[model samples]
Target chain A: MAVFVDLNISHTVDKKRLQNIIETAAHLGYSTVAINHVVDLQQKKQEIGKPKCVSELFDQFPIVQGKSRPIKVLNRLTLVVSEASHFRPTNEFKSYDVVAVFPKTEKLFHAACMSFDVDIICIAVTEKQPFYFKRPPVNGAIDRGVFFEISYVPAIKDSTMRRYTISNSLSLMETCKGKNVIVSSGAEKPLELRGPYDIANLGLLFGLSEGDAKAAVSTNCRAVLLHGETRKTALGIIHTMKKIEPTAERREEEEAPVLKRARTEAV
Target chain B: MVRFKSRYLLCELCVSDQSSLQLLDDRAVFTGVRGAVCRAHGDYGAALCSVSFAVKYLNADTGVVFLRCRKSHYRILWSALPFITHLENRGQKVPCAFNCLYVGGTIRTCQKFLIRYNIQQLHRMLPHCHNEAERLEVRRAVLNCSLKSLEKEEEEDE
Candidate 1:
């Protein structure tokens, strides 16, 4: 079964609150979650560093509500790029499980959609989308398996932000027609996080059909995770270490069968 | 008599402070529900809710409310219920939420389900009684409520 995943949890300095948010997410049946470390490239004197290891957050990971397995926590880095040169491919990005880009301008958005080596392109929900979502970039992003993420935490906090969230998402939905869109909660606090079902229902307001809304929390997030995986390897071709012991055992068995056949032929 | 089809939502007001429920009337809930629907679902949903929305029954003591709306648009209102964080009453924001217990086609069905739900909640709470006195008090209250309900049924039968 495709498990539910919340791909964006705002990374906080407060350990207690972050634990609370993850615990709440587990209680609400999220099988996987990502702690997003955001770096705004527009700001000067900002340094990009390796994200904190997610395993160190808890001694024992909390179990998902209905699933028998513990919730999978992943580290993600969101680079907010205003200018074209803000994002540069480096070994530092490879340390994170997933990489996301927030484009501040239409040109950057087009670039991010077409050629950016990222898993998710975040749609700004705090303010109105400065540029309309054109057909070419959105379709290209969908074709390239890059998902658009719309965070719903701002909408839950303030009514004015809620309006912006709805309108911005509606416009994106108009161009993409709800494909490759993932609705995640950029929740710093536990209360801001809602259940997956509640968000799927909320997706109706964002102009997604019933089925696509459900997929936004499950299948689309999984696809983004897979897209992120390709970044670590050369064109999604992973060469894993093979166990030599199993091959030796199989060789011995094959030799024994061949010896028996030769003896039978000689007899 | 013209038969108007409607759907009734049986919702329970979940709050930390029980007294805050007293300030919640039909109008407060109406405004709260409408505002939430408007915020979550936009003007289209708000318009759908306003057409035939009414608070048919509200038990302030128990925090149970029965909301009636057109059958086709109850889903829009239902989907928006979870977005309501609090209800503003008398210049104070009451920290609460609405948990929809049941959705029925008529008020009678909702009333029947509410009685059944209350008895089930009573039975569930019986074991959590802190002391012997509280246990005995809960037992007495349960017996008295059952007896009162039985009497009402008998009166209706007669």
Candidate 2:
């Protein structure tokens, strides 16, 4: 089974609340969750600092229901860009596992979708989508393996926000044809978080087909994680560190068992 | 006999306070679901939903609800079930959401599944009882329910 993942839990100042949210996520069968720290550069002098260590969130990580493994927590940084200069890729961007961009204008939206090397382009949930999702940029993002994210927490919190969330996601789905889209809960509290299956069903209301809706919770999120991994290496290869020596004896011994079994079967 | 095609949804209304469940009934649930579908899926969904949607059974005590809809449009209604945050009743609002447990082709199958699902839930709750008294009480309840259900099944079989 594809392990369910909720890749956008909103980072909160209250440690206890954040811990409760993560525990609820684990109980809801999320195998992995990303704590998103948002930076709105529209505010003056907003410095993007390194994300806090995810390990400090809990003493022992809560085990995912039905999976019997501790939920994997990851750090993410989201930059809300209103203007062109709002987003700058500093070394701080490399500290997090996933980077997301919420563009506030048509220019920034196009830029974030096409040229920006972020993993996710966050669609507006709290308000109406400011600019229309033009075909070229959205298609370019998909071609570049970047995912468009729609957060559901806002919908849970308010009815007006629910209208925006459903409309915005439908617009994105219209142009993207439900490809390379991820639905995540930007839940600041435990109550805002819904189960993965619930979100998958909610995706249908967002204009996604049944299979694509399920993928929004599982496979597409995995693709986004892999996209983040590739950003760290050169073409996903060519590491700067020296290579370690392999044990030739161990390699031969590992090969010998399979070979001996094959020879015995042949005899 | 020609039978009309229909779908039955077995759902559980999750509420923080059990007292709030009393406020939920067939009409309130119907209104909540209709409003949610209209808001989320729009007028077209609302029109499609009013076709044959009905609340067949509702157990306020256990929070179980059986919603019946046309087979062709059950998916649309199923998608809207999660959006129901609360049901308004008698000038008061109760915070709750519906978690769909099973969708069956017939009410008979849904009832069968609900019994099995309730038993599984009871088994899960047994370990969480706080003290010896609570544990024993839960055990007796479980045994009583199983015996009653088994006897009912035997009567039906005969």
Candidate 3:
């Protein structure tokens, strides 16, 4: 079975609290989690900065429940783009493992769906969805492997946001038919985080079928991670890494035996 | 003859403070689950959950609970369990979350699963024991459970 991944754990500056949240996530059986750094370009003087080194957060990563392995933590950058000019693909975006966009306008939403070099598109959960999720754009996003993220923290915090979350997700499901959707905690506090199975069940409440609901928490999130990796590679299909050079001592030792064998064969 | 089937949900109430677990009762958990079902699935779910729904067992010390519901409406209850962020008791909200461990068709199966689960937990706890006394206590607990199960099986064989 595909391990559970919560791709959006709201980034907080408090180191202790962040560690607590990650520990809770590991205890709750999340194999992987991403610390989300959101940059709202609507605010003046907003600049995309390099993400902090993820290793500095924990001395020893907590082992995931039933997995017997330490949990993997990744950094994600979410750009809140209000205008076309707000989203600029920069070097800083490459520093994060996953990139996402939260579009405010219909035009921006379309752009995010069809052309944005982003892994996740954040669906508005705290407020009502301003634009309808047209089938064309929603299908385009699914085709491109761009996932729609619905954060459940707001839904748990208040009834109004819960209404908005359910309605927006239902409409999105209508257009996308529950494909390429990931449900994340967006949890700043430990209490806000729910287990993967719980979110899978909540997916049913969001109008997803039983299988699709489970996928929303597991396989779909894995696809999103692969999509994010493709951003750094040449079409995710081909990957190239620098070959390590053999040390001089090992090369001399191994080449001598081959040279001796060649000499013996020649003799 | 048609027999009614039931689903038993074995869940653990996870609390930030361990002591807060003692405040939980079966009634509080039932009400909390019912309220959550009403909120998540609305009135229909509430009506479904009300039928043959009950808290079969609660261990306040361990925070383990067994919730019984009709097989037909178990999904509604299972889905709503995550929404129960806390249980209200005596006007004081005990902050907790229900972690459903297993859903079995019968209480017998649930009990058998819980026994295996507790043994696994004991095994996990064995290495964490600080002193010899704690280690022996864990070993005794593990052996005692197995012995009881063996005795029960011998009785059933007769």
Candidate 4:
């Protein structure tokens, strides 16, 4: 039940806006916040270049020719997020409470290179595009170190809740899962996203077995969201998430398990 | 991949004619785009690709025939198979499923893919035809052969 604040859509990525949102999210005691990229995937990568310092140069222009996983731009954002986590902020943000996302799937794959080991979040589409990079930012990514996942819906609009669609996507999900992949919302904005139980319910309505639905939402999504980045980068993650803090004790009632109502495969 | 729960007929008149004549087994694989979407290529929104397709019959003058495809892939398939143009003509004796693609059991996008960029697996399938009548017959034959063989295999396994 993580609440992702959409940084991808906001007009500003400047310090003021970022800090303000972080403080709000932290004070709200949300366990995690996805730094969503609002624009089209490619543009977001170009905004951030290759990582600086030491042995590796991710900005291999020749290597990252295509817009999707251009070497340098992809690597740069990994460093940026890693560095940004250490950015000096207001007392609340400095508490190291939020994890950032480049919001670009291509950059995410590259960021997961040797420099960083994070999952690339993708959106599910009828069409397929190359989301994995050849030379990842890290070494073990291809063989189960780095993870990836896509946000999916039963149908976007006017589409029927067909089993083939689910089966096909599920097949793809299964295939990717074999490669250390995770499933995600790839949600454009918050309103478009459903919580864990909501996603699980969607699975049930779409012909998935109860086990599959539970795995898709509860296990699959939680595993992706509660990643190492979510764990290591944030200073007060467990402290804020745990009932240990006096300020967060008020969330006890809200922590009730989500309602088990079934969600239709399509809206 | 995309799929539709509803079954679509390639040709209503041809379907009734064929089955009654014992030319068809009432067994068929109708191909068409389901839950289709059309959009511009990128943020620039420069051009548009209308993603639509369905199964169809081709070279109407000669005989009965059908084919499956996606509208977005029409250009590629048309270029690959010369007879595709003849099928595109409205007055031709055969029509085609230009609006969709059928692969295996479910209707799907004709576009192919692998697990990732670096992998070497193909994810989609498409039909090839030269004329309307030829195309329809080919589509029918493909479905019939595949279904009959599958049934035989199932019977054998049982």
Give each prediction's DockQ, rounded to 2 decimals.
0.20, 0.28, 0.41, 0.02
How do all the candidates rank in terms of DockQ, highest first? 3, 2, 1, 4
Whose lDDT is higher: candidate 3's or candidate 4's? 3
lDDT of 2: 0.83
Per-residue lDDT of model 2, residues B9-94, tens digit only: 88877676788898778898888888988876789988897788888888889988988889989888887776677789888999
**All candidates' TM-scores?**
0.72, 0.79, 0.87, 0.29
Which of the numbered candidates is closest to the native, going by highest lDDT? 3
Q: TM-score, chain B only, every model?
A: 0.85, 0.86, 0.86, 0.18
Clashes of each: 0, 0, 0, 41
How well is each residue in B35-118 modelled by candidate 1, as lDDT tens digits?
888876679879988878987767899888888899988879877876787888767787666666678997778878887877
- Summarize candidate 1's per-residue lDDT along A139-255 as a digit string, tens digits: 999898999999988887788898899899999999999999999999887656777776777788788999999999999999989888867654555422324787677666655
- How close is candidate 3 at the interface, in terms of C-alpha RMSD after superposing the true interface residues? 1.5
Which of candidates 2 and 3 reaches a greater DockQ? Answer: 3
User: Which model is ahead, 2 or 3, in terms of TM-score?
Assistant: 3
lDDT of 3 by residue, B56-154 (tens): 888998898999999988988998887777899988899888888788998778878888887666654465678999888876865676567755863
**DockQ of model 3 vs. true complex:** 0.41
Model 3 stretches with alpha carbons more than 4 Å out = A237-267, B122-158
Q: Distance (Å) between predicted and true CA of A150, model 3? A: 1.1
**How much lDDT does candidate 4 score?**
0.32
Docking tier of model 2: it is acceptable
